[model samples]
Target: MRQLFGFLLLFATAAPLSAAEIHDDIDADTGWQVITAQAGQTKIRVVPAAGFNVFSIEHAGRELLKTPPALADLPGVSYGVPLLYPSPNRVRNAQFTFDGKTYHFDANDGTNFIHGLVHNVPWTVRRTEVDAHQAVIEAELVFAPGTKHYAAFPLEHTLRVTVTVRPEGVSWKYEVDNTHGKSKVPFGFALHPWILYQGERKNTFLTIPATQWMEAENLLPTGKLVDLEGTPFDARAAKSLEGFVIDDVYSGMQSDHPTVADFRDEGIQLSLDASDDFTHLVVYTPENKNWFCVENQTCSTDAHNLYQQGLKAESHLLVAEPGETLSGTVNYRIRDARGHKFSRWEKAIRKFEAQDRQHPPAAGGTLFVGSSSIRFWDLPKYFPDRPVVNHGFGGSQMIDSLYFADRIVLPYQPRTIVVYAGDNDIAGGQSPETVAKDFQRFARKIHAALPETKIVYIAIKPSLRRWNLYEQMAKANDLIAAFAETDERITYADIATPMLNEQGTPKPELFIKDGLHLSPAGYELWTSVIEPLLPRAN
Candidate 1:
């Protein structure tokens, strides 16, 4: 079932979770520590002592980060995310040979040592700072001389972690300073964030842009890398998260763009972005559990072992020399994707709502609404006599207006709604019939709320550049005009006819240089036709 935590949620910090207010404190135990930061509505909690993990990420009023309600129930299970280093995933027999020295470790995972040793130890808080736009915290955990953790590997080094939260998303940086005078340390760094879900897993969709899968046995790599062809790990695009119980490592990440893994269920969506340095990704879906992990690793599991065995040309181990720093950054963007026809426009919706708050328009007016064409329209200039409220957001689709209707439209209680969308929707791959149906649904919705109010749907005009979709546009306009005829309150404002020339071809004078949007004279022509339908002043 869907759950709501305390009212003090992180929904504001939820999406594009980036910011600049940093706060530092220690856990009640004192052995653990915490750093809380805020950026706009985005709020983030970084627990440095508890493996340098993010304890909470709240936005608006919802906590997007997942955690075990209790930490004591399962041994070695990280309720929060865990920062790992030096052979990240698994080491065979908890041992590896480095420069003739066979270093051994305690097998924490039955026969393998997973997630590294520093994840359980305390990290000293180095610094904390905040600016107007972002908040950052820096902490370090050093491998002390003669300590058991060091003695097992006997490497003198310090691993520093810095996490910055912003209104857009949270970014993390990991830097390892090799203090050894002569020896170059070979190590792996990784993060295991347990992003969980509520309700049905079948409803949720997952996306990870990876190209290869690491062939492993018993969670340990067998020094073989293979393509993701016909395998269950092929998540090149967004697909279902159910049916395939995955605990696998994938490599060959898409370097041209920021590596992203998107998770969406019901109305909520979360996207994880990583630096180009994060070439390897580990997708861990525990058996019969609600939580899943999309981990970013510097190298494949047992990188040191793979490098020692000479099976692969490069094992991705950051062989840092003395006094060198190896670092990376990762960001998390959470959003509520309910209103959008497509999932990716969550940011645009948030921006629109924010814009409304910043510039509150007067209600009970003739509201002009739609995509960019309507957004860029000079509403007041044309309809000077009438009280006008323009709620045209970004390049919005007809469905987008529907999704955000409650917040953008109905609240205003407008006597008339003039819409000019559907141009971009068809370009975005929707059929002409779909756009017309969406308009019909939109009219029905408006009539349901305000039966006396009028709804004027502007016929999609032909653009010289978008002449290819003009046929589809004409078909959609025909359908909308027909539907408008069914209701006395509905009015179809046909602008397409005036824009067509003697040969029924588009007039270049109607559009701007881009041939997509309207020009001043174009609005003049629009005013000439649409002016007749608009209610006149008393």
Candidate 2:
């Protein structure tokens, strides 16, 4: 299906556009397939013959991966990004019993088989394409009889990997097809990417978004989970890697937050967002080393043996029955710390676009856009009979709404638009003036593209947690309301004024336990204030 879409995109433009390009230069003995995107702002180098490994990923003239000094050293060096599959990290004694069969592997790492086969082997290039939006390279390896490593594992399966480079960032999709095999196959997948520190190594901040750590005695999980509270591997928040030496597997990964590496000195942030299949993460920050490894694994180390030992949940061993295709994606996004605010919301926007394609909302409906306040609102419950389209992405500010307006708002051609943002902007340290100015730009952009559309700006609400910022919120609301009065098509819904108590404090019952998000009563009150401004049900 992706290949078909790429083929369709090939004829999308009448004229040639230098958006993204794919080049294959294997005759030079380099055997590199390079894909460049965003007008050469980002480049990804893949060697199809060398395990289909993405050896180099350069962005903005900076190398993100740790590459060898010489090209000849690439094949032997363990640097760059390599996919560890079938079994990741290590297998106990290079042997594991799965189902009723026992298999053995080469002890590549001292009495244990580390990082399964196919990482350094040749793979067939299934497809490569360059479209206006992105460039893609798809490679596959058939792990059946006659294959190099098939005699050891003997699993008749096909592993397909697709790497895509776009303006936003790079994404990898790994898939395993076990349709031909009659037996249930057990496997694990992981990506070992040696990341180079962009600036000072000690100043590099890492956020793992994990709560539990796998207790390992010999570089392998011991089937025991430990809390990372006081351990040296507790990096749930953005913590500096100074004086920290860790090479451990972490569990209880939070799906909402991505594993991030913030280069504060370089003003660059590298984030890795993986699918739910990736429930475990391995962080390896060696002492006296300029590079660290943040590996996203589908299962814990020695998952097969651990699963056989009845530690199913902790092992996360994936079983593929007949005709099952196990697949997952991991996206690598790069953005500047000072700018590219909307890049973080690219996944959310893509999800919305995909939803639009499947079950599109009706045109000329009342559209709502904003931060978590709008995102958490039960639009259908509040306005049961009205036609409303909600595009509320949490953790968004006024500028995000304005930036994505063309994609989500204008395309809907809604008759009325309700916006409830700027709460997070002030909380995030942006000034009230900047928020109001952003809203002003948002209004102008909306009015320019959608002249007759009625825009109802929901005043930033007052919360108990941020009661101190009420003055700033009120100032922004006043600026927006005053601006709305100048425009006949705009309406400023002053929900903030009504949410306050007689003593001018935020009502405690109006907020949830967090004292920030709205309670049911608070949303009811907001509905009473903004429902009247919405388009009436016909």
Task: Give the alpha carbon lDDT tens digit for every residue of 1-538 in model 1.
Answer: 1122221132222122222466555444343445667765467776665666776676543455575454321123366567777778888888888778888898888988777877766678888888867887888877778665677667788888888877666777888787553567788888788776643677667777777788888887776778887887887767677786788888876445444434343345777767777778888876678778888887888888898887543367677888776777776776545434433555655675676566655555688888888878888888888888776766778876764554456656677889989998888777787788678767766665566789999998899988999999999999999988888898999889889999988999988999988999998998888778877754
lDDT of 2 by residue, 62-95 (tens): 6789876544455522878888889989899999
What is the overall TM-score of model 1 with all chains considered together?
A: 0.60
Best by TM-score: 2
lDDT of model number 2: 0.82
Cα-based lDDT at residue 80, candidate 1:
59
RMSD of each: 10.4, 14.6
- Model 2 clash tally, residue pairs: 0
Q: State residue 103's C-alpha deviation in candidate 1, in Å.
A: 1.1
The segments of candidate 1 whose C-alpha lies over 4 angstroms from its true place after superposition are 1-19, 29-31, 70-77, 146-148, 257-264, 312-314, 335-538
Question: Top model by lDDT, which number?
Answer: 2
| Candidate 2 off by > 4 Å | 1-17, 30-40, 341-538
